[model samples]
Target: MSRRILLVTTLLLAGCTSGTPTPTPTPPPVKSGFKLVAFDSCEQLTKDLKAAAKKSVGPWGFSGGMMRTFGAVPDGARSAASAGGTADKAAPAFSGTNVHEVGVDEPDIVKTDGKRIVTITGGSLRVIDAASHKATGQLPLDAWGDADLLLSGDRALVLTHQGGGDVLYDRKMPMRPAGAELILVDLTGAPRVISRYRGEGRLVDARQTGDTARVVLTSQPRITFPDRPAARDDDEDRIKANQRVIDRTSVDAWLPSWTVTTGDTTEQGKVACNDVRRPVTYSGRSMLTVLTFPLSAPKLDSGRPVSIVADGDTVYGTPTSLYVASDQRWRLDFFPGRDNRTVPQETDVFRFDVTGSEPPVYRAAGKVPGFLINQYALSEWDGHLRVATTDSAQQSSAVRVLKPDGETLTQVGEVDGLGKNERIYSVRFIGPRAYVVTFRQTDPLYSLDLSNPAAPRVTGELKITGFSAHLQPVGPDRLVGVGQEATEEGRRQGTQVSLFDVSDPAAPRRLAQHHVKNGYSEAEYDPHAILWWPDTKLFAVPVNEGLLALTVTDNGLTEAGQIAPRASAMQVRRNLVIGGELWTLYENGLQISRLSTLEPVTYLRL
Candidate 1:
């Protein structure tokens, strides 16, 4: 295979709400399984908060109080015909941002509508016209670090964190305080910030359906601890002091605060108590707030905010439902005994109904035995939600099907003991069939039959030498897997792309395999780094520092070519197929290439 190195100095790229009075609390759904219950009043919420905090408080704060955040998935293209591209027109067929579901767009570093390409790089939002093939306009943002954005018609919502990316800490250094900043920009002409929002925590993720965007933020309680304790103070003494501080903290201090600025006016408020809900069992340590914003509105206002007293690590959204799952890391008891036993390894999932343009309504809650790997671990289909989990204690993985009854998600069917002694690496649900990959020493790909929700059983299993970290469906009967090629001893070598034929659920087989020694691709773990053009049957992934493009065939994967921009210092973060041109986004600029020939064209430096 031939390789193209497009050298260019200039081309490279880079990449809510306020409180309001809520309506009367809806009665909890009537289900025999677990559920989330809203607090009746501020007084009741305060009482519940204090009691939970006081019991859970310890020397460092709430016991087992660390929060986990997952990486966002990559861009997705709907179809070759969409985005206003036709062979008869001056522009060729084009592709939009790669997303998980149709009509549900995720925030990404780059986006396009066939005519123009918009991206964020070096704290600035840049736009390039496809016709002119040149930089058109730019807007400098007040961003702290790296950023991503969601596009809706002539509007763009750019998300940034205060600390300029994830912070690292050590015994000698202090943890940097972080917050999330969302800037709403108008894309009618030159991009300009029309409104700005600052929230108390980092952004979990955001998803858009049509003109509405829903953002998820996770925040810890805003309580200060003593910098230095007395010399005589011990662990127990410090624990007591932290508990006392929790006792004096008011309900407002535990909720997430927000400030939204529009022109000369600004609104500031914390999440309302009435809008907060909690599971029957909670540690009350973290607040998970979901804010809904109308992106096409004249000006961005404080969004409709609804919050829950739980931690959100993974967020998944479909057209009609949004699911948030947490690993539930809190301790079982507020006070620790000598044993210091913690809560069981489990994940709590909350479902919200997002049918209309209104704010999402809390619909149901459920618990699974093990924790989820990422957003792909949860799939909703045919009025049933399927969850894949791996329990460390049991040394096995399982797929459980749950149905929402009134206010709870009750398990209807379960298949456990899968890949015993291994952990789940990837999972994908395609209609009635499900594929699960688990790996320790070797990879076991399990095909499940979910045609009957109440009796989901594993139909077939394929043991391979490596594991796939991310699985992408090619069509109705094929899947493309991106992961590591490992040894018999479970040692990973490099990046491997495998073609899986699932035409027969009872017996699936690997059609072809391509291995890159010492190669690593972000697409292995972050699906957002992958670009699949179905019309051409081309799969492009960021391997090492360049974009590796592959041609998928029935017999095998043909290496189309590797395209790396001239800016070798910066990594290729994303790639887009816009009107016969392959637009590659680097950390600093953009590179345009001829999609058919994989040849370099003009490049733009932002």
Candidate 2:
């Protein structure tokens, strides 16, 4: 679900009392304070969940719970214009999906392999031939909500939700309808569903390595509660009723249930109770499950799954590690009229080993003082996990380094006193260096040298009037920032693109900037919405109502042209380059244009 629950809370950091400055000795390193412990049996799991519910459940419900490839062509990609190119012409170069890591692929609404483009939109899956610039095949999907897909050699793994948004928990009768589906599609010929896996949960996010796809999901106990309170019923009465519902709820109600349909032969199952684990501290209101699927399989099975009795909002993955983080909310933070600002805030991160063809194995767990902004706030480098966090109560931010020690992520190094009054707006980790942007009245772009994990230090700082919500690397010496320009008073005015020269780590400067008044781009919050074609130096971000295309000139970014797709009913979700054509994706269909001149080529209404 795209809906985010804003978590602003007080951070508790232990330190020496503030008084006459006395020379205090350095303290010893800190170890992870928590770890995941498996339940002895389903009965114990049920008892622990019930106890947590009785202590934290609210009147409405348990609150909270909530490329790769550096532009390398995809594997088995055919010639760009093979479907219709003349014998004398050569296939034009194409770019693949923009990914955080080289080998790890992130799921998106659209994907291409030069010759053909596969996309899920408007409640259907469509494939378009790049050379012909026409829809070659189509498959109508069921009544699933918004969807995205991942591509293998000849298969596509599509993720969809029953309800379009986050699972809503309010004073409602059956709660809001919520479920998720994983549809495997065959792309050898016409795009068609081969197998469908449906489950009761919200699709968190997913990552793919080679042909193996791992999907993360979160689900609440399937126990029905009462509707809106009557005129006479108070919060106390509702809370008691909710507690009673939890009392009678079975352990199966908390486990994720799923059904796999392959050619009408359906099978059902639930995450085995013995396979579930939970951190030392958790609300037990929700659970996080990770399912593994091999896209090359003829029929999809309810994947080899692993479950944990905790809620996760952010999922960050590498080829070897998958990290799930959740804001450790105070039990009463969601209660009526409770001031969250006074509640102690912390974030718990669980690490899983995702190597080989097997399911993810829970490795270790850790805790930090404050919550993270998103998956970007975390970066795994050289066996150590680096985290950036903002403490709202402290009005400050910090970067920490932790390494897996035994069954814990032990804190090894840390640097504090960053952006005194602002939180982190963007973070990018490149090798041994890290860049962070924090803003309130002014944006402070700080470059930190993380070569020494135990002693990371800020190398330079640049205070600008605007803040970048996303940062994309350029040739190892520059960065392209997409965000909004703001006034000195911290009021955002419009969309802004900036080119920075970071060749000198201690003295980074903005080479050029472009602004669009009163405009906003989805790239600010979603890096997937932005595309950077390094070959042609083309950078595109969806601004305001259309695609704002820019080219990286020798000195700065220049407005190449704009592509206003004909699919007016849907917003421009993604942009890709195939051969010499630029393909723009909308919910209704696809639009192709010449990459050089931005001339319209053809429109495919799927």
Candidate 3:
């Protein structure tokens, strides 16, 4: 809701070993520690992906439809696999505020300073003053792809992925390059452009502690072999063509371009070669970048940029540390082509120290069992990091606590015999306690105690017909869960909000359960999409049909009212409470309603 405090922990860099440059061989080895590895040239990456693709994929029995899913994979390999930037609203006046997370601060599509509401889901940044209840001047967006806004004091940072976008900050620029732009806007009076930093990558996510913000970006190179044949009759021909073309390329061809536009001057160069670290597997090309900036700084480039040679899919951050996790299974070759049948069954955890530094420094890397469900699957506490994963082959979910040991993560505590024949539905970490929800025929909420890092164990388990996809703490021992209500056979019925009391870890009980028929909410997936105004004790979630509102208290949850959905799109993307009013954001405009009466205040069509 406002400024967040960063807490420093002694165990953050406890077992972290000094980073040393190690000369690595081809097909980089997977070690317990992280090392810097370069591709030598673009040719190496081109050749490797083709060979991996040919081996994983078999004959030409597939179409070109599946190739669009992989973010940075080589072209022509069909089938299998895919996959926010952070997203928040305002806080209520009563009990604390409605921030994105309990301790973590993530960027969102909309944020309010009690007096004004700022939203960015389209080509421009719209600033609405809560006091006036009117639309103010907007910052014109000029780039393509997705963009998000972050605010602190008199400054606002606009992150844009320059690929394909409809609205933009600069209209005269015809071609939106395949890069990114970090435009700094001064919010002292009317929004005015201050500084712009042009970069190469997609904005993964960002978090702010007070005025300091850490932004993560993933950059992939676009490589091509001019001499390579477009069509090959056999697999061998394809492989040789790839290798031949790759041999002629260099490393610079695969590196991302970087530039900073300050006033009338611009500086350009490639990301430093030695500042990157690579994973063991010859997975495709992608660089994980962490850039840090101060919100009150005069320019956007008044920060530092660091990168790792890894493909990060999920990220979790604390005030002093940031952890990035990647599932290297997608790079494995198990067929005649890069087929999507069998994915890797392991995850790689990399930790970076962000305490008292402009940018985070890579500290260590370790391997963990199975894959994570999302960012919530990782947590750092009590001088150790705990990860939640599910082994698809075994159909079991488990929690593992790892301690930093020099360059590796040594397992100090673990509990694996919990949920079987099912996957993890939700995971929430509250201090030394962990609540893991797994569902198959039913949802089992297992409580785990991690007070002793050497021996974390499950304290209790409660089963219900439906399941929770997201978990939130209503109080110290109470949790508010949002997910789908299901049948005994595991068929999803609709959205269900359940309250649980875990005062006694060994005997947790369901306090209240309310089911919304045929209703699905975005809070089930993106937790930032939830809006709980403490003043009225009303919780609002975006559903497929409309905005479902409910009154949540210690007693139970009761139906309040529903905000009318958009006429054409018929969907509510985000909802937030500011200045004692409810704001529902859609693709076209914003609907403001009185928090008490739930009556329409005004509509600002964009």
Per-candidate TM vs. native? Answer: 0.89, 0.89, 0.81
Candidate 3 lDDT over 543-563, as tens digits, reads 885888888878688878888
> Taking the tens digit of each residue's C-alpha lDDT, what string does model 2 give over 31-90?
854778889988898899889867667766655433000011111112222111112234
Write down the worst ten-residue block by lDDT for model 3. Answer: 74-83
Error of 2 at 52 (Å): 1.4
Model 2: CA > 4 A from native: 1-27, 64-92, 164-176, 228-230, 329-342, 565-570
Name the better of 1 and 3 by lDDT. Answer: 1
Query: For candidate 2, what's the RMSD?
Result: 5.5
lDDT of each: 0.76, 0.75, 0.64
Of candidate 1, the 10-residue stretch with the lowest lDDT total is: 1-10
Candidate 3 ranges with C-alpha deviation above 4 Å: 1-103, 162-178, 225-231, 279-284, 332-342, 566-570
Ranking by lDDT: 1, 2, 3
